[model samples]
Target: MRGGGSKNSPLETLGENANLEISGDLISSSTTEKIFEVSTNLGNKIRLAHSSTSNGKVLKEHGYIYNVDAITGLKSITVAFEGELKLTTWYDDILNGQSVNLINNETSKLSGSDCAWFRIEALKETKIDSIKIEYTCDAKDGSFAYTSFDDLGNLDREGAKNKNVTVSLGERNFEQFEYAYDGVEANKYNQKAFVLGNTKLNKYNASVPNVGEYKFTFLNGIIKGGADVKNPDNTNNSHVFMLLPNHSDVVFENVIFDSTVSFHNEFYTNTWAYLNSLTFKNCTFNGGIFDFPAKELTITDCTFNKYINDNGQNDSNPIWVRSGAGQKGEVSLNKVTFTNNTVNAYRPVKFERLGINNNHFELTFLDNTFNMSTFNDTDLKNYGIYLDSGVTYHSFTLIDDGNVINGGNGDKVYAFNGVVDGNFPTKMGTKILDRNGNEKVIVGGKWKSIEEAKLCSSIDEVATDTNINVSSSGTAIDAIKSSFTGDNATKQSTTISLPSGNFSLKDETDRPSLKDKTVVFIGSGVNSTTYLANKSATGTEKGSDYSFDGAKLVVFKDMKISLGTANYNGFVRPQNLVFDNCLIEGMGHYWGDKTTFNNCKFSLSGADYNIYLYSGVDFTFKNCEFNSPTNRFMNAYREETSTEPIKVNITNCKFIGAEDTASAPNAKPVVNIKKYINPIWQITIKNSSLEGALNKEKGFYQAEEGSKGFVSIDGNVVWEAE
Candidate 1:
């Protein structure tokens, strides 16, 4: 029999020979502020029935043979149990004074026994000084099927600061373990820490969705996949851990992701999510893709071992950072490395630019090593790092410092537009081992080195003789300047030739001045002679308005003119300029009159206008090739008051895009005539074989509205659009 007790008296008393089976609600009076106890002398166990009171009160079950229900009120309850305590419902806001500690310690480990599932969901804006919880379940022979600690709904609401919650899980080995914290408000600044130890599991997954700060530390356990051991498959598609978007100031250390993991935005409307100041230290990723967009991302002392999966799909991108829909970000890889990494499917690291504006996207790779000896694929186009062509239109920067590539058949690093400053591998024919640990050799190539092969591909064999070999006395530009202004300065037309070598113009004072000079530069061949500008000098000069200007007739034949890292405005705009059988690479704006190109090739390297004509008249191209990967070939605009109309004539010419697509959908118009008030522009293409689809009519020229321009397409075979 049970009776009421005071603050000092006993609530229930059982005799030595009595057998009791209690089943009902144990209630306390509203005004009673007392301590309840049970006095037993028969060594019999007392059971607390699972019931709820009318008033807001907490009912906690301890010891053995007890089943607890939901608890409510401001007062906290400490339930310390020796045997298993079955928790069926949720308990929230059960504060005992200012702190609470709930401990569940089993006497011995049991096999096939289920551990308690705690859904610790805090109330809205609830405040507690500190809360400590510990759960331990040691299985002797077998493990629990599933164990989860999910923080459902919104926890840590606004103005709920310094909750100071700590959770510890020990010796609880389960087949599946999940810890999820979702919907944390932005203003809530809570310090939460989780310590997990010895919980060897078949599958474990965790997701932290809080905007505030949090920390997690894992120690001394192999948290792997399901029971298959070799092929540990899970129903949740093999994602181990996820740090959701807008999660900042979080640190995860000493965690081993032996299974696959992804940091993707699984359920979010905005494609461009922000994850700032998140760091992973001393982590190991076995096989999977790590694709996320972040700002100031740091990964130190990490190892990635990527391999193919069962479905014959190599979804192993070690590090893949993509630009958000409209946001800007940066990725930093420091002291990270990859080992046993095979490139059977995709590239190792890819920086994608999905956004239009990418001025703020930057990538830095420092002290990293990529071992590509295990790559078995025969695709030579595969690369260790691939910066796509979309970055050509954006302002992106790449810093690759102290990085080493052990072996690879394809390009080590491939970028479209960026300032690359590092000691990269220059020589080709470096032995690359395949998956069978055998060295592969390239056969039937003209050049032994890859650099030489690239140089030989663009060589023109128009002229074989060099008239006057103008070797550089100091600088190439200075020699050209001295040749035109020295005692042998000629008022008549002169031909200055150069031998088969590279001439670099690197200094500020190394700019050649060709004012009021008529010169023709001839070389041995297009590939043999190259004039390379310094990669650091800008195109703009102080005194002169143009890089090269004021020439009656300036001709360049059988040579390559490379504008290395120079802007469009940093070029020589000569009057009556002619190019014959030459390779004009890189980009520059040309403004002149009476210019002619015969059998010349103009190949642009970046996304810049190939030719910009200012007050151009009688410009003609015969059997020339205009090839640009992205930018337009020509942009011709006229002055309003000028009566001299800009005229461009193309005959027997070939206009090709990047990949020689018959209809180059990726290429801009071949000629774009701007609208002017004076309306003075004319374009004519005759007997030309154009390979790009530039306009709606599938023609080669595009004239602006209200511009007095005439586009005459005669006998031109315009290919179909791709």
Candidate 2:
């Protein structure tokens, strides 16, 4: 039943490092739950299914660790599980009339409606102690099969009375148990048990569909000759033992995967899928490369050592997100934690988004140790946790809890090889949170809390044509043209990040519309005396708002763009435009959907409107101030082409009218809304102020007669007029 045959089992290939021996009358359990377990007259514990619920009722009869069969003369035992499937002398335990003789060396397999598979190797005569197992297996450096057995089938240990004891020798210190067996004590067997308790047919693969909840746990063993090869497909494949997405959970505790052979460790040779939840606790993964993509993956108190091979890797390879065409949906890895783990890989933790719909990818390190391994002949991609590029869908943020990562030759704990969007005070490294979740940063390995991240004119991320570090004095628009130098068909330089600089278009320039591009313009924060602005315009000739051919996300933060007579709308979008803590002067922004202006200021004197909304579904302005000296603060004439509704919310904002008293009386309302064909505008203005507007008494809003809209002010606005 456990893979059904002997030839399919792995042949013994144990390491010939030394001989082995154990040092006790019995090897006790090290885990707290199983440590106090003492074998009674009852036989082995018939576990229904190994789970977190360890101490409970068994078979509706006993709660003790063992249960007896109550048979005599070549004594037998009943393995009563929670399913009530008892293992006896009949086919109830064996299928094809294969009788189970509980002697030495031979094992019997049992399964039923409750259990999937279980193997009983050697039975005990009342006084034996090793342990039961869950889906997890324990690996041992030496073999457990002793060469000699007594007349009663007992081992050669002292106080050993009963028969059916299969002896094994090995040593290690996991929790409290100490195993330092003498190598010259006895003969040893050669076996390379990659997984314990599980048959070769049941080594969990992610690509396979789940049969049930897969929770494989490994505890306290030396895992040797381990290979974690992650080929695309066709080497070796398994369609069983899978993880149920959002349901499966596995843990490896106090284990070591030691691959001393230098390169036979190719475990999975297929398009590996993903892990729902997995953990490696107090484990050591030495000398091999493992590719693990997980939704919630945690590596705590583990050590990764000697990850070098004979041929060796060119550079450090990070997490694989498919360097080829991938499946649709959000390409993501979330809530990955490394706590108190020591890693000495070529380049520690690199995560690439793989030029797809990358939503959110983050690495949270708390009190871990990371150092570059200088002892590798292979070239290094020393940029740790480097994501080559970001998508136009969501911002890429770095939440550094805390770590001791060496910044060798300007090594970064995490980095982006290309464009990243957000209010980045720390260039490509944006929104790095501290232990308390405040904004933080890293300066030469050590991290420090900052009041805010400041933007500057530097290519802080990986030097790619997709990033533009604009210069005012030496160079200007070349950085802009260089950002679009890649192949336009694949949109290679699609999501470009514009660093802080005073970029001036000395002549009339019409920047080409970006199809499938989302540009994030960075600048110093609103409180900073330093600033990022479009260089003083040469003439008074303004252009239309920047229109994207096909865009997903656009953000401009801590920056200013004085579009005072520039024939180029360089930024803004049709979807997901979020601006924070920024200022705009003498310009109008055109937006369509999901647009938010938080903690910002906008002023466009002698212009038609500060905002010319093309279309909208959800628009918000929180803690903003708009000084529109010419007319309305905004005029929203939605496109009748889209069926999406218009939802505009303004909270804690101030819309000041014309500066001169004479012009204030002639100023238009705060917002001028035109009629739409189908969708109505549900506008809500709360805790806002309208000063010196022409129509402040009417809540400072004027909609056309046929306009389908409801402007709800809630009487919270402080309306004033000259």
TM-score per candidate: 0.33, 0.39
Model 2 alpha-carbon miss at residue 309, Å: 3.7
> What are the per-residue Cα lDDT tens digits for candidate 2 across 1-722?
21111111211211111111111221233333232222333222211111111222221221122111111111222332222222233211224323343422123333322222232222222211222222111112211111111121222222221211121111222121111112322422122323222112222232343423344443344644333333223111111112122223445555555542111111221133444555766666664433344455677767767464444363333223332121234432454676887777665454443324444445567876677654533333553444444321234454565566664324455544432222223334234456686443343221121122221121223223255555434233454455554444344333233344454323426554456555555554443322223344332223334444355655565666554433223233456666665676655444546887765678776556677665557888866778776656767675455565578888767887655546644455777777765457677887678775343543468777777757878644332221
User: Which 10 consecutive positions of candidate 2 have the poorest summed lDDT?
Assistant: 13-22
Candidate with top lDDT is 2
Model 1 lDDT at residue 465: 19
Off by over 4 Å in 2: 1-38, 41-212, 227-247, 260-274, 316-333, 354-358, 373-385, 390-397, 410-412, 419-431, 441-722
Backbone clash total for model 2 is: 11
Candidate 1 yields a Cα-based lDDT of 0.41
RMSD (CA, Å), each prediction: 25.9, 16.7
lDDT of 2: 0.42
Alpha-carbon deviation at 190 in model 2, angstroms: 20
lDDT at residue 216 of model 1 (Cα atoms): 28
* Candidate maximizing TM-score: 2
lDDT of 1 by residue, 476-550 (tens): 455556555556455334456777777643444655456766666666567678765334545553222343467
